[model samples]
Target chain A: MSRNLFDMVWDMHKVATLSTGQDQLFIGLHLVHEVTSPQAFAMLAERGLKVLYPGRTFATVDHIVPTDDRSRPFSDPLAEEMLGAIERNVRAHGIEFFGLDSGNQGIVHIIGPELGLTQPGMTIACGDSHTATHGAFGSIAFGIGTSQVRDVLATQTMALDRPKVRLVRLDGKLGTGVTAKDLILRIMAELGVDGGLGYAYEYGGAAIAALSMEERMTVCNMSVEGGARAGYINPDDTTVEYLRGLPYAPSGEGFEKAAAFWKSLASGPGSSYDDEVGIDASSIEPMVTWGINPGQGIGISGRLPRLEDLEGAERDLAAKAYEHMKFTPGDPVKGRKVDVAFIGSCTNGRISDLRAAAAVAKGRKVARGVRALVVPGSKRVAAQARAEGLDLIFLEAGFEFREAGCSMCLAMNPDKLLGDEVSASSSNRNFIGRQGSPTGRTLLMSPAMVAAAAVSGEVVDVRDFV
Target chain B: MTITPIRSLAAGRGIPIRENDIDTDRIIPARYMKGITFEGLGEFAFHDARFDEAGNPKAHPFDDPRFKGGSILVVNRNFGCGSSREHAPQALEKFGIRAIVGESFAEIFAGNCTVMGLPAVSASGPDVAALQDLIEAKPETEIRVDLEAMRVGAGNLDFGISMKDSYRNALVSGTWDSTAALLSNLDAIRAVASALPYIGGFA
Candidate 1:
């Protein structure tokens, strides 16, 4: 039977169908991290089930690892123990682990593509919501829970019902100053957080094609934020070129053959979709989340929406969002005073995002009492940023340049927000207490916008700073 | 798993908190969230934080002993927000919470509690207020949650809870297998898809 890329890939990875009608998808790649994998690996030990596909699994430590002061004993005893647990688990299982000593360690999502472990047409699973970040390489990647993590480790397969497909087409070009972060925020705002329920999104169209692999990673990383099961782009020269010269990518003639197969995974020209959404790229602006969920967003220049202006579930969410964000309806998101300004996370913490933020902070000083931090998405990115003197620019501008890890992004590490501090953040998710303090507030924006807010001590348009 | 809605009541201040969405981090904190059974987690609830730097519950409500004896916990929406760690609720249950009442709970939080037999009651508007009043008026007040009737009564206050019929039925019937239910209809789904006029290549 004729099939779309998604269908062909799904068939390629299927192990069996359960009585529940969900296909038992055989994971071609499994990624693990310190935070969620310890218990899963322990569970495997308890069950005495060796990993069926050890070669397919790769492990790293990111969350809870201190970005500054890399030493034997960690300040947070719990973080130290968690790291030790991961080390023990991986060692016991005889799996490849990219430890701090390896110099190859970073965020699980970041390291995947940087190391070329994420490849086109592969079914990837990880114990992280941002596992979808790997889908940028034209892979079918999704995050699995801890128990499901165990399933993948033990049998390398998971029982998941096939999601209906949603075709999202964004045509034309993004305006200047618009980035992938804005594109995704715009999509979430248009679709609402739950818009993609029970569906996998095939992101197509000229705008997606125009994005670099890093940019695509930023987009697919937030697929979960849009409630899509997963999101992906088609394999093209960009995908192949990005994978080439990477540490783990097949080399020589083997790579050439793989590239051909990868190119074949593109959706056929006439392929149909269950649900389709067409968006004009011009319609999307540099967007930011004004309220709790990612969907409660508008253009950076736009005003917060009145609750009544929404309909059905949207209205209810708007009301709740207002209550949680403690913001009056119809207020301007710009110029909102911020005590903290963060410009990092897997969402928008890539090297390019760092460059944008540094450019914004150039020759400018941070606002008094405003604490700003610049964390690279990976160790490699961190080294490169230092080589480019991006770190020096940030430091001179009064921002703390820390080593790489998922810092402040979740505060599982030492980096955290004090009570009730309102922060302008480049990281996604402005949910209640998401930044650590129960009453702490977070405003999600682009890295450059965060830099502007850090210097101004309030939300300022990055376009003006530029 | 079957989930029953329970009317959430309000009680605050000096109450021992069985905080909703108590993930392994908050309940046991990351330091002690690992290793042993959840048996000792109750005493360790907010171990690193119960008191605070000054040994007080300034912002954290975990140290409030007033809500300690209350079987029901009133909570904020999306009570379980971060992490898929089930140990959060495990510590709460170990701390002696039998049920949680909130505007809504996280999908993972509710699922974990279901497996552990901890009932999460979802309430709305007025019913939420009545529960609050009842709990505040009597610290040790116990509210019985009736999944079949979808109601909670404490003293003179009565509250109604709503959930999907399938979920309610599952709670009442002691079968909370949503996946099994979906699976049972696979043949029917196939039949319907085949019967559809234009759903080609779907199955």
Candidate 2:
């Protein structure tokens, strides 16, 4: 039997074998958001069910909260109503909520870790797909639908089939300017979009261990893009160190005990995985998604694949991408002019991401025609960036520094692309109209690359910034 | 806690969406999900993909008159690939998609369909391609998905389909609405939670 962290955590939470042959898994942490929770709450009310374990659930507003002008009764009535629903629901259920004035509010994935609520060996569930971002802390976290959210609320457990574990080991170290974003993009590219369909990815090896907690999050955040519902790294000293002194984490002796328990959950010698795949990290370059899906990516120095180079479904999707993006196959990816530049999302909106972007924007000005925006993932991240003067650097460079929210990533709020504008975005997902405009184009890259594109007015390599 | 058992889907007209990796955003754009409830989402299903900024109808299968009132959706590989938004499947369900036949589906999307009592079944690539072609060629052809028989039938053609056995069981047994089944084991859940070191702060 597989003895990895995923298997162990899964077994620990397995409540019973349901009639359908699925395991009834107890959810340790249930994160809720504005967009997907209201209907679930309504369903619970209709069923006359009360929240089974209110303390285990946490709520926040991100999907529809306006990153700019976040005053009451948001200019958008629907957005305001959605926010109100969450506020009322959390209050009624006694679930802790990090609202606008809470000073802890942010993207659900970002706040979960920053507040220390996301810990090792815990099974976390959220309605948003990016919930896999929590897996960086060695937790088993995955996204669920509204009905599953209702189940987690009414019963504190969900019926799920166990997914096999795929050990994705990355050897060597990433080169300068090649970030965790690039590492994950390359993994998605090699694995295709549905490669991890029924598997949970256990990311390990020297390169994974070398990544900081935020960097690891960036890697695990996009696990869903490669079709893995959950991805995680084994807890180590770095994991413990990052959790130390956080608001929700245990303190002093309790923390030491927690740390030992966390370390014990790591897959040890002779542990086996269902499958193993290894890649050399040093070979990966800064990646950019040229197509709608996250898998349609290439290294910064590479050119788009020609039609004749692909076959079957791959060829068909490439043909569609070329027509939709209006880019010729076999053309160089660099020097493509961009109209907007966005830096923020659950994927790359933390303090570290802002610092990396600021380092690039320090002595540069945004291109004359480009509109750039920097959105922190949470209020805490924004405060930390301001304290470090990263906001000043971005503002001086002509980038609009806005309040923390999902922002241009999903474009549920007012932040959106206009017309057929092309954007260099740090947010995950370049799906058609994902940036809020059906014709708008997005080039997925790291925060630094987004900064470089903002300054150069085109798709340029971040390595050139140095 | 009760749900309608979905043992098999009766013959119905199929809508062909022959494309690989059709993401959830394309099914229902994020803007339309701003509403508090999934009500009235059917009209907005595939909103951006079927209409231009000016609200002019685009050349989409959903807008094509031939596929009007289609209850089954025939698609290519990796359908519903991005974003775990239940709105995507809910939009399709509200738009009258009772069952989905595709080459493959994202795990979360398929799971969402199951809980909602909608069946998202899969077949071989060639089988799916042929089915899509058949649907496009004759939009009035009746298609039936039989979970008990593990096959899809239309005219004299029969294609073997597969789904997660657990999902099939849940649907066939009307246990797809799993909240009741999970809640029934509260004692076991409490026992498991108490034994876990993290739940009690590892003290």
Candidate 3:
């Protein structure tokens, strides 16, 4: 029987089927960070259980770590306590810790791939939602709750019901200035936020296959926003090349053997899908979210959705979004004022993402009254960007170049938007108050689009500036 | 380590929220997640929608006196549509909501609810609308969710609910406890881990 890549990897990882009928899937890697793991570790301790397979687990402090200052004893007591707890827990459990000073420390999703810890034909679990970022390597990665995290720590496995596979095929080439971020935003807008429920999205076709590894990561990173349990691009030469020399990757002839094994895991030509959706990459433009959710998006030049065109619950949601966003139906998304422009997150914080943003920020100055920031996804990403002088380019354009952390993404740290301040962000989620203030508004866009917003002081097409 | 089986929930008053796509953010805002524990989250559930800027009470459904002690929440399509935060279900579970019947639910949110022993069942859009109307018409009327029969009923109105067989069996047999399942398969898990080259080395 022909099977898609999702089923292939899932079947490979199946350890047992419990009497409850859930598959006991072995996790090849488990990533943890400060915010979610402390409670999980505490839960394990309450049960008097040690980490069953500490070798498969890795820890880092990202979510609550302050981007501006790296010194210990953070200003936020809760943040400090959470970091302390993870540090102690990882040390006691014999799990690898990528601490604040570990140069490898960054967002858990970013560090995993860059270190080659995320590999094809593997089942990776994390306590963070963006674990789908590792799916770029053709791994089956999904976010789990703290209790599930405890289960993984204590048994190196998790119980899950298999999800049906949906093929999201993107053919043709992306137009100039369009990015993987734009592609995903366009997909979410077309599919609606809840379209991928109960399905594992297998992203493929010419456009997806053409994307660079970092770009692929950006595309897979936002799969959760579209309600997919997981999303993956099948392993190919691009994936193999990206993993070749990473610190944790296999070396020399072992690399060749691993790559061959990975190649075999791709869906065969006769593979079938439960459902398939075709998208023309050329039809997409520089996309931006105008409303509260990631699905409430339009092309930079497109107008807001008309409420009259929608019906029932969708109409109500659009109305609520318009009221919350202060955007009028049929109005252009371009020229909307932005108070802040943020360029970073696990979504678009790679070296390539920084280079793209720097290209837009090189010659122009940020518009007066607009506060812009450039945060790297990982310490290694930060170092690479600095070596290439991307930091200087951003700094010269009046953007604050900060340390590596999940800054302002959830605003668990000090960096946050003031009340009702509208921001142009390159992060994944645009949920209400996601950027800090109770009513702060976030418009999700590409990193270059964020740079364009910084210079224009409003949402604008990145193609116009580039 | 066994979870208590929840085959059937007792009949109870149902609260109706006519809104669709009530995301996790609206359930419990991100700022409230800074705490180490989930304690006291019940007070802040729907904090923004339930209160005005000056901390005055608003006309949100959770704030209505009629639904103060409602144990069942009937909602519209795509309830809990954003974020994978378990806190959303935790807050709902703490806020006296024992069961949720909606037009649909986000997959992760539904999974989170199952883990918390709060059953989130789905029905058709018209059936959900009818359920909401029934609840609004008689807020004190008792509604029962029968997992065994895969139906929810209130008076003469009953709607068929759908859930995955695995999730249904887990909820009914108390095997929803993932910890217990993991422990039972520990030896198999170790064997799998030991076979992987990456896990064998690097420690």
Candidate 4:
């Protein structure tokens, strides 16, 4: 019988069927970061336990790391303590540490793929919601909690109930100025934020097949926003080629063997799915979120939905969004004043994302009064951007080219929105207070759109500026 | 490190919040995540929703004197919608809530609650709405959640709720303490880790 990619990978990782009826799945890779792991490590200490499979785990600092300055003794005492705790915990447990000085240091999701650590047919777990980012490589990745983090560290296995598989196929060619970011925003809008509940979204079809490895990562990264436990694109030539020469990837003949195995993991022609949805890529335009949730989105040229346009609970949510975001119903998103323009996150902070934004920023200066920032997802992405002088292009455009970290994505660091400042952000999660302020508003858009907003100081259509 | 099993719960009052899709960010705003521990999270539970910009008290359900010590929370569909922050469940648990009955729950949030020994049971939309209405009308009514029978009782209303068999067995059998179970299977885990080339390469 043919099986989907999710079932194939999940079957490979199933360690045991517990008496509780959940599978004891062995995690092939466990990624940890500063913010969530400190308490987990402490939990292990309290239990007098050591990392049973330290070799399977890796640690890095990202969430609370200050993007502007990396000097020792961070301004925030809590941030400093969290970082210090992770450093000690990793060292004591004999796990690999991607410290601040390490060139490998970056967001856990970004570093894993760039280093060839994320591979097809593996189960990866991280103490972050965006761990779904690794599913781009055809692996089954999950964002777990601190206690589950401890479970993985101590046993390299996590108990989980298997999820049904949902096939989200996007066909046809994407129009110019449309990107993976817009495609995902469109998916979330069409399928409500909770649409993918109890399912693993398997992304396929012509449009998804055409996206680069980086673009595939961006699409998978936001699977959590759609409420999918995980999302993935099948491993094909694009995936194999992207992984070929990375540091941890197999070499030469070994690479050939690995590629062949990865090819076999793709969903077979007759593979079945619990549910399926198809999207016409040609119909999707540059999308933007106007409400407090990622699902409340509209095309850049389209007007915000009136209260009457929405039904039931959504209507109530629309009213709350209107009051919080200060967006007028039925008004076009264009020309809405933006206090900040941020172009970075694990979702769209890869080299290609920066290049796309740089193309928009090359000949234009940021509009006065807009605080613009471009943060790379990883140190390697930062190094690559600087090598190509994308950093200079952004800086010359009056955008702050900052160090690699989560940065303004969740704004755990100092790069936060003040008061009720509205921002055009190329990050995921537009939930209330998500950008570090209670009343602060975030409008999610593509990186190029965020750049256009920086140049125009409002939510203008990127097509106009490009 | 075993978590005490939570087999059954009986609460004198249930706090009802009619809003749908109450995300984790609203339960405990991201700013409060700066701490190194889950301690003291109770005070900050619903900190933003319950307080104003100037730190004044707001008219939130949690703040009502009638529901001050409510151990059961009744909410609308898609409760705990975003973020895998266990802090949301941690806050609810810290705020003295032992169980949650909602129209539905985001998968991760419910999982987190299960591990923390906080049972999150789900009922049909009309059943949850009826429970909320009944609770609001009579705050002194007793709300009972029984894991063995898989039912919720409030006054004359008896609503059958659904829970994954695994989650229910874990809670009833005290096997929900995942840390202990994980630690017990160390050898098998090591064998699996050794078989993976990616992990073996590290060694």
DockQ of 1: 0.08
TM-score (2 decimals) of chain A in model 4? 0.99
Enumerate residue pairs that collide in model 3: none
DockQ of each: 0.08, 0.91, 0.55, 0.57
Q: What TM-score would you give candidate 1 relative to the actual structure?
A: 0.78
Q: Which stretches of candidate 2 lie over 4 Å from their true place?
A: B1-3
Order by DockQ, highest first: 2, 4, 3, 1
True C-alpha contacts between chains kept, each model in order:
0.03, 0.93, 0.51, 0.49
**Clash pairs for candidate 4:** none
How far is A307's C-alpha from truth in model 2 (Å)? 0.9
Best by DockQ: 2
Error of 1 at A105 (Å): 1.3
lDDT of 4 by residue, A1-466 (tens): 5899899778777777888999898998899998778878888889898887787788888888999988989988888888888888988999998889999988888999999989988899998888999999999999988788888887888999999999999999889999999999999999988898899999999999999999999999999888897999999999999998999887877788788888889998799999999999999999999998999898988998999888989999999899999888988988889999998889998999999999999989999999999999999999999999999999999999998899888878898998899999999989888888888999999999999899998888888765
The Cα local distance difference test for each model comes to 0.73, 0.93, 0.87, 0.88
In order, the interface RMSDs are: 9.2, 0.7, 2.3, 2.2
Candidate 3 wrong stretches, greater than 4 Å: B1-7, B195-203
Candidate 4 residue-wise lDDT at A126 = 93
Instruction: Report how far off residue B62 is in candidate 1 (Å).
Output: 12
